[model samples]
Target: MFTHVDAIAGQLGRGLLLTLAMTALAFTGAVAVGLVVAVLRICPVAPLRAFGAGYVTVFRNIPLLVLLVLFVFGLPDLGLLYPLFATVSTAMALYWAAFVCEVVRSGVRAVPRGQAEAARALGLGFGQCLRHVILPQAVRPMVQPLGSIFIGCALSTSLAAAVGVAELTGQAEFLTLRYDQPLTSFALTTVVYVALTLTSGLVAGRVERKVAVVR
Candidate 1:
């Protein structure tokens, strides 16, 4: 067991790097899509609002794994071939975007109505009000929830293994199969996941406290 430590460490390092890459890609894409959808959902235009609502409803209802499979296996026949990691990242991002949209919309709605009215009275246009006044206030309260979303994304990287993405869980499974060390491999994976979750929680807690203080 001691002799295998170096090999295990190397495998874990690779897995961690892959997991981080996936998480960063997913979070960036999700944030972009979610912010746009959230703004559209609150827009005065009926069609845009309806479209945003429909998008959220549809994607939020689908299972992430199903979406992953569709992207990885189904898209090739349609000439939309994606690398395994890219496919997994795209699916996860799209799936997570629906939830992020709802979270951000709720944050936007939580902004006091008076703030928007005051901004308008001060000659701020809709975009200015949102960019300068409304969103700044809304985002503070949303930090904790957004942190949880980040943690969730980190955990969801495990699903990438199903699509042959070679993320943390994927590497762990491969190592276990190769070395016939299921117990050791799984134990290490569990520990790594726990550390990741705990780190997320700590960061979130600090942000939550800071927001409370600022408020």
Candidate 2:
């Protein structure tokens, strides 16, 4: 029973690598996309703001599983044949990007209006004001909330298994079927997920504390 774990140890390692790869790539992409959405949502232009708001509302409402399926199948029909890994990572990034935009929006809002006014009074344009004065302060308050978002993004990678990315959960399923030890296989999968999540939370917590402002 327990020996089945040893039989597929190499597969387990590869599965973990895939899961981590998805999480890392997706989170990085989400942050970049989400930051742009946040800026668009808050910018002075009405149309841009509307576009940003609509994007967040639509993507946030869609199910992750649906996005994964769409990326894998729908994109191919549209003449774009993204690989399984690319499709899954892009889907997860888009899904998480909506939420990350909201988190970042709140952070941007936390900045004092006076800062932007000061920057503008100094003859700086809107972009300069945001870059030099507003964003520096806004980013400070966003540490904790964004940490939670990061953990959520990390766990969301599990859904990639549905599209055959063969991440951690997928490996367990394959192993269980091959070895006929459902309980042992899945039990280990649960532990691995828990460990990954806990480690992520810890790292985020440390980084948050490091950047936290006392005032």
Candidate 3:
């Protein structure tokens, strides 16, 4: 049934590469932004904490499609025109960062209060305490949540197709129309997506088993 996929393997492969690139780049940015937001959420500074909470509350509630539209069209009039890849990556990254931040904040909260206090007993400042003691312990539990968030981030890149990014779903749709074979084209696409998600879960399992602390 899925016959056209073989003829378009090169095109699909290119699309897959673009999808992976967008996902990897966006996830990298998400990790950085999420870490900062997470740290700010738990920091001693009240204003920073409020800002972090506001950021999460806003971004997490907004539809990712709206964010993609904003990056693609809204920013251009604001004199912040980016190339298509950059536009999609930024939108996807920022959209997912809110969720990632919350995941990390939960991990931080899972850490015992005594850990921070003991670091303070060593004359460490709040940042140093987080760096040397609390976060180190907190990060172990974070691996699973972070992995899931990133998987969602990868899947979310499909939204970028509306802005002409030519990611996996976009290519599948295009091929479907071109070959007049929606069943075959999309079936293969579904298989690829399932494989990717399964691989992500397996990797997350390995990481969780290896480094997860039972607390």
lDDT of 2 at 80: 92
Q: Is candidate 1 or candidate 2 better by lDDT?
A: 1
Q: Model 1: residues >4 Å from true position, as ranges? A: 209-215
Quickly count the clashes in candidate 3: 0
Q: What is the C-alpha lDDT of each candidate?
A: 0.87, 0.85, 0.86
Please provide, for model 1 over 1-215, each residue's C-alpha lDDT reduced to its tens digit, 9 standing for 90 to 100. 67878987898889989998999999889988989999999888899999999999988998888888888889898999767888888888888898899889889888889999999999998789999988888877788788889888889989888878777898899888878989889888889988988998898888777765243
lDDT of 2 by residue, 31-67 (tens): 9999999999989999999999999999999899988
- Give residue 54's error in model 3 in angstroms: 1.3
Worst 10 residues of 2 by lDDT: 1-10
- Give residue 167's error in model 3 in angstroms: 0.9
Residue 186: error of model 2 in Å?
A: 1.7
Spell out the clash pairs found in candidate 3. Answer: none
Considering summed lDDT, which 10 consecutive residues are worst modelled in model 1?
A: 206-215
